[model samples]
Target chain A: MTKKKQPEPAETGATEHQLWEVFTQPGGGKPFEHAGSVHAPDAEMALQNARDVYARRGEAVNLWVVPSSAIVASTPEDIGPFFDPGNDKPYRHPQFYKVPRGIKV
Target chain B: MLGHRLSEWCGHGPILEEDIALTNIALDLVGEANLLLGRAATAENAGRDADALAFLRDVREYRNALIVELPKGDFGFTVARQFLFSVYALHQWEALSTSADDDLAGIAAKALKETRYHVRHSAEWLVRLGDGTDESHGRVQDALDELWRFTGELFLTDDVEQALVKQKLAVDSSSLFDAWKRDVTDVISRATLRMPGDVYMQRGGRSGMHTEHLGVMLAEMQVLPRTYPGAKW
Candidate 1:
């Protein structure tokens, strides 16, 4: 098990401040999409940074910022087993099914 | 002039995010100035447009406060100035949003939204800088102290504005002081900085009197237009 990384104390003057992963919503009840990352001392600053960095030019109607350390990403070593595809299953694809004329995707 | 000062941070901010943030603010201010200038031109009833008024103005003719005309000292200074000015501007806009005049009210209503965001951004920076480290705290506190005197000018109601205020055409600048002070005190206390008390307030920017810096800035800002009148791309 990977150890959960702790965020640094903001006022201690860390060399590299905490990294925040940015997600932005494009409005109209759309899901938030990963935009980019920004460096900030804490959550409030992270949100402001995300607004300045990612929300310009009408790119976002909403923004979300998460500490990069809080995210647990899979390693390349686990690629084979974690997302293994034992065989091609053509029937599992939604496109394989034929629908009546009145049906819509 | 504040917009001009903010524009200096276009490529010179400490971080990429700040660079964009400052420049975005600069653009917003400049746009606001453009609209205000257009409104002024119509009010003047002269044949001048916004460009004419901006490019043709002399040093003493420009009625902007001294704080904005001062050079962009440092990031701390810029943030401090933004906080002070944005707060005042926000209140002014809020009051003016309901003015009897349709044009001024419409402009103020739109500007209120932008000013609100500007206040939020600057206030956030003020807290971070004032509480972050010993060096940052010292610098930002110094900035706040230096900017404190200039804030009085924001509440000064000139004769023209007072007359307009009577007719409900302009906001009563003096009336906004208490609310502005309360908000400023709250933010300063939260930032853990002492608010400088009762310094000699600077004044006289509204009557066409300004600092020496405005001339140099105007020279730079108006050179092209002055040289080639009616020149266009």
Candidate 2:
């Protein structure tokens, strides 16, 4: 007797690994700025993965890759009301100060 | 000594990608060596700073791993040495990032980023050479076999490590060994290269003993500062 055969599942995209957030410094004098994210198997691989994904065009002088899980981030929705209180502080604005001619702020 | 040996690849590498990678790695190592030697100088109360330790010190006085002092032979050999050392360094830095000594932890935090890249770059090269072709594969395998002996000293426990570990300024070298072995094995497996088995381990870099390659390297590296003494830009 012939039985119905089970079909194999179709192949999917590359397996998703842990996510790592990348930060990069463009040059010696520059501050390290957040770049983007990459997927990798481990920290060592995450570093290389970030290099290929973020620094391909010599855009980085340094790089930092930390597991996304390791980072504690504030959500925009949660912080919006918390940050709005500071917006009413007009005294915090530097525009209130007058500087001499040829002086840069 | 570490800077001198690393600087040998400043302009000479098999490819442009590799040349830049090696030089960048060298620069990072030099930077770390400067920081460490500066701390060592301060600890010794020698009234010497990083420059004095880096430039004025005689060959016999330098304390760096012999693996770092060995010359960059071919691309394969360079990659093999880098692969081993970077894995060891990465583990060291990872552990040191939590060190009770704030300065050491800070240095480890910064240096860890660079060491991570160094490990990846070399591991990639190892895989490439190992899996490329018959000739390339054979050469890389040979390089690994030759360089394997020197790796033992990387984890050799001694007074410095013990003292530093007690002070919480350094990680225990013995603890790092298993992680390092696992990393290298994974890379080797991916590279299709067989790990050299049952080889005699070379020792004596932590105590200032080194291969003959170090002397020539020191001569060139120390020349500018030794000749001028106090010259500055």
Candidate 3:
């Protein structure tokens, strides 16, 4: 609640319209993936616009709409400290475990 | 026919994003037309293929609603026409999804989801235009009044629809009117726009009677196909 409204970059060439990021899940059990973004004034319109722009080809069975302003994003400068810790921890990966000789693996 | 009408606004929407959006909708409708006409070609048992049915049909043979055949007036007019038509289409498709004909039911099931988005898109625009500034409100109000007469044709049924409905292969369009009215009234009220008065509505699209606009549109649409009969890329 205390977070400031995030400023959207003008990369979409729609500086005036409110930006909404669209995420779509292709089918049941499928992970939601970033589809695209749309410009709309409100959430309802955003969802509709997202459907028009993203899911026209039956590409999605589920959709999620988030206002660009409400999103909390990390900057490029945060890559080193914010992400590197996870990268160096090999034991955290499932592939790190060695298979026993008797097991199918 | 709807694709052609919508395609007229291809590069002419109020904004770039909206322009592409309208074109995308046009393409979607064209895709549906392809499916329906393909079915009609075989269902009619005529020697004609889908292309022939589409490109060779006279204006009198068209089964589309008059509302879709009407000329595009302005942004307000386009939005109003689309809002009304989309609502009708949503209901029609919803009912058709359960059709006894598997092909039609499959098509309708797919189309229902698309029309759902179309309804939301057009309904949102109607509200925006109707509740906008004084100029916008006036423009959309005038559009609604002008377009209202053609809407009756959407609910008009004929022998063809009756036969199909009896077979559970088509939706009963007449039954959809009450729900359509209620829904339209609700949307209009949300937009702070008044519903048009009960007046004698223009009709006759079901049986192929149409305004001159369809002829002009047909002429343009059929030109390329007619000119090069067997040409394909």
Candidate 4:
């Protein structure tokens, strides 16, 4: 919900209008998970394309189509600083402390 | 049938996303036909099943509207035909959802959901193509112009539908024209396209009289069933 689309990414080709990242909620109360992607001119078509490409045969009860440009993913340059710092510290994992039963850390 | 015609676009849509989308709608329509024809067979109290009615019968015995039988001319034409038919079908299904016949009402209820999506999908494409660049705009307009004549047959009601209407067993398709027109007019205008004028409206799919194209299509569709008896899909 927080992601906002960035405009005029040069990679968008002549025939391509936009690329959308599809997310699906498997059931009520479930979190939306990244499903796949589709190319459409706008959000309306993106949503429908998600349904057509992913929702056939009752795959999901709900759908969300986010513009791929909206997502801010970590680049390769950030791999060492963003991820490696966490791996050296085992106490960051919940197993180091008393945890509620059935709770996933 | 329109379903078969739509299915032909399975691997041939202009874009990959659209290709999958169009074929999904085609499958929905094909499923609708299977259910409707199965019910028709039961209603007739004849030994014939859906397979026999669909594969064994000649084109002359078909009762579908002429618009569905015409060739899928282009991407624009396909979307235009879907928009035209889905709007009408939505209305018809709405009326049928309250039918006195329980089975038909159930089928209508299920079909109504599918039809809503069909209407949305086609209407979106129509707007995109019609309001698009010169080439897209011109092509869609031409397609719409060519398909306008076939719209009249969709609302035609004969004695079969009339008898069922009186008994609350069928929808009065003729009565649905006004709403269809209103909805279609709004979408066409929104698409930045002019409505085709009242030219000569083609009719007669109800009587099984079709253009020369149907026979050719039927040959391809029915060949397997006609040659290899008792073939199952």
TM-score of chain A of each: 0.72, 0.72, 0.76, 0.75
Residue B23 lDDT (model 4): 87
| Candidate 4 error regions (>4 Å) | A1-13, A98-105
Q: Residue B187's C-alpha lDDT in candidate 2?
A: 95
* Residue runs of model 3 more than 4 Å from their true location after superposition: A1-15, A25-36, A72-105, B165-172
Worst ten in a row by lDDT for model 3 chain A:
A1-10
Q: Write the per-residue lDDT of candidate 2 for residues B69-142, one digit (tens) a residue.
A: 88777778877888888899999999989999787788899999888878878888788778766667887899
Error of 1 at A16 (Å): 3.2
Tens-place lDDT digits, model 3, residues B37-136: 8998888897887889889888998877888988888999988988898899899899999999999999898888878878888888898878776777
Q: Which portions of model 2 miss their true places by more than 4 Å?
A: A1-105, B1-3
lDDT of 1 at B3: 89
lDDT of 1 by residue, B46-161 (tens): 89898888789898888888888888888999999999999999999999899998988998999998899899999999988887767778888899899888889888887899
Report residue A8 deviation for candidate 2 (angstroms): 40
Lowest lDDT block of 10, candidate 1 chain B: B129-138
Model 2, residue B37: displacement in angstroms? 1.7
Residue-level lDDT of model 4, residues B85-132, one tens digit each, is 999999999999999999999999999999999999999999988877
Q: What DockQ do the predictions score, one after another?
A: 0.32, 0.04, 0.16, 0.34
Which one wins on DockQ? 4
Candidate 4 lDDT for residue A103? 86
Per-residue error (Å), model 2, residue B222:
0.3
Could you tell me how far off, in angstroms, the CA of residue A52 lies in candidate 4 after the best superposition?
0.5
